[model samples]
Target: MRAERRSGSLMAAPYAAFLLIFAAYPILFALVLVFLKWDLVTTPVFAGADNMRMLATDTRFWRAVANTFVFLSIHLPLQVASALMLALALNRPLAFRSFWRAAFFLPVVISGAVVAILWSNLYATDVGLINGVLVRIGLRPVPWLTDPSTAMPAIAAMVTWKNVGFYVIIYLAGLQYIPRSCKEAIEIEGASTWQRFRFLTLPLLLPQTILVVTLSTINGFQLFIEPYVMTGGGPLRRTYSIVLYLYTNAFAYQKMGYAATIGVALALIIGSVVFIQRRVIGNAEAL
Candidate 1:
């Protein structure tokens, strides 16, 4: 018994050490850094809650939070509906099913930086593919990233388009788990297609719905690469995300302490929002 226990401990020790070095230490140090000032060039000096205080009152930080919520409001529903619809459409027996699935998922496997760059051209106001289409349809070209009102939503839409393929795969996998008997029974009970989906298919996909909401919400909060590469958090700072703001603080402003504070606050906000969303969704499921 002693030898077995010792052997298990030896086997797990490397992973435990790795976690301590990579995860635990960084987390602890980040928390500590939130109270101290350091720019990597100057000596670290303890500021003691100043960073937190500044972050709490910073209007720009609040604006970033508000912008994130705006992005999510548009991104989340669009993502869920688009993914679910595509999943539903592809669920039935269709020609070249694997090919269709692969095509849809191709964008998801692409790098975010590449996606952002690709979309930048597609969204350019004067020479964009979107603008060209609008002009061909006799409509005025609209500035996607150049207008404050449209910039964030444009980014949200691009993100949705980029990630919908991944979530489609998710919903597709969820659709498979739904019992065929349940679907057949609903149809036998004289339920319309909409009713069947509303009652049976939708309810059964609760876990996937929860996953989509949580993952998309976290992604919305962490939006940096898209805005950074595309808009540079520009067009009146409409697309400025929290992560972008944090990066600006750390790199440009040399406010490492405040950046860590933003990180901590972001983590807390994400955790709380996801918790509330789960509770709400769970209660809805129960009802």
Candidate 2:
């Protein structure tokens, strides 16, 4: 038994070493850096808890947090609903099925920078494809990225469009696990289609829904490239995100300590929110 245990440890040694080097060291150093000021050029100086204090009271940080919530509020429901609907539609036999799936998923595989640049032109108020259609229909052109009220929502919509395909794949996979017998049983009991979905389909898909919510929430928190390339976190900073603010602190302001503090805060906030979301969803499922 001891020899077997030793062999198992030997087999896992490479992964353990990699974890220490790549994961453990960075985490430990980040915590250390949260108490020291460094610009990646000069000697680091101890700043104590100033970074934590500033992070707590920073209006920009709070604003970014609020903006992220706005993005998530719009993105999460739209993503889940759109993906689920598409998965249901494609669940049936259809012509060019692979083509449709590939088209939807193509954007997800493209680089974020490329997507942002493409969307910048697509969202241009005067000559945008979207606004052009609106104008042709006798409706006024709407400011998508220029107006603060619409900017975040517009980005959220775009993100949903980009990522919905991935979640559709997820939901499609979940749909397969649902026992056909259960669905047939419900149908034979005089249950309507909506009732069948509500009672049979939706409940079984809870795990996928939870995964979608958690991943989208994390993605919302880490939003930087989309806003950075498209709006530069502007038009009243409506699209600013926590990671963007963290980058500004470290790269632009030379505030390593504060950046690390922001990183820590972001991790805490994400953990708390995900935990609460799971609890709430679990409770609803129990009901």
Candidate 3:
């Protein structure tokens, strides 16, 4: 038994070492950095709680947080509705089912940077495809990325379009777990389609719904590439995201300690929001 235990430890050694060197070390160092000042070139100096104090008073940081909320306001409902609709449509036996699924999921496999760049041109005010269509319809061109009011919403729509397929697949898998017997039983009860969906399909899909909300919320908070590539957090910083601000602190300002503080704060925010969401959803499910 001792020999077997030793062998098991040996087998796990590499993974344990990797975690220590990569994950654990970075996390611990980041926490430490929050209490110090370092510019990557100079020696680190202890800063006590200065970083945290500044973070609390920083309007720019709060603005980024607010921008994230704006993004989520448009993103979450659109993601759930579109993904659920596509999943339902694909769940039915249809021609080119595989093709349709693949086409939807193709954006998921594509690089986010590429998607942002592609959408940038599509969102361009004058010659853009969307605006061109509007012009042809006797409407004025709308500045998607350049306008403060429309910038974050435009990004949210693009993100939903890019990621809806991934959630469709999630819902599709959940749909498969729904027992055919249960569905047939509902049909025999002569329940209308909407009645069956509300009473049956939706409740059974609760877990997947929770997962989608959690993941998309996290992704919305961590948004960087889309705003970075498309708007550069412009149009009055309406598209500025928390992660983008953190990046600016670290690289642009060389404020490593403050950047680390931002990182810690962001983690806390994400955890709190997700926890509240899960609790609210779980309670609703129980009811």
Give me the candidate number with maximum lDDT. 3
Summing lDDT over every window of 10 consecutive residues in candidate 1, give the lowest-scoring window: 231-240
* Reference-based TM-score of each model: 0.96, 0.95, 0.96
lDDT tens digits, residue span 1-287, model 2: 99999999999999999999999998899999999999889999999888888887889999999999999999999998999999988887989999988888898898889998898888999989899999999999999999999999999999998888899999989999999999999999999989999889999999999999999888877888999899989889999988898999989988888898899899899999999999999898888
Give Cα distance to truth, residue 86, candidate 2, Å.
Answer: 1.1
Query: Mind giving the per-residue lDDT tens digits that candidate 1 earns over 1-287?
Result: 99999999999999999999999998999999999999979899999989988987999999998888988999999999999999999998999999989989899989999999999899999999999999999999999999999999999999999999899988999999998898899899999999998989999999999999999998888999999999988888888899999999999999888899999999999999999999999999999
Question: Which segments of model 1 are wrong by more than 4 Å?
Answer: 10-14
Predictions in order: lDDT: 0.93, 0.91, 0.96
What tens digits encode model 3's per-residue C-alpha lDDT throughout 48-128? 999999999999999999999989989999999999999999999999999999999999999999999999999999889
Residue 198, candidate 2: C-alpha displacement in angstroms: 1.6
Query: How high is the lDDT of residue 24 in model 3?
Result: 96
Candidate with the larger TM-score of 1 and 3: 3
Q: Please tell me which model should have the higher lDDT, number 1 or number 2.
A: 1
Model 2 alpha-carbon miss at residue 12, Å: 3.4
Question: Which segments of candidate 3 are over 4 A away from where they belong?
Answer: none
Candidate 1 clashing pairs?
none
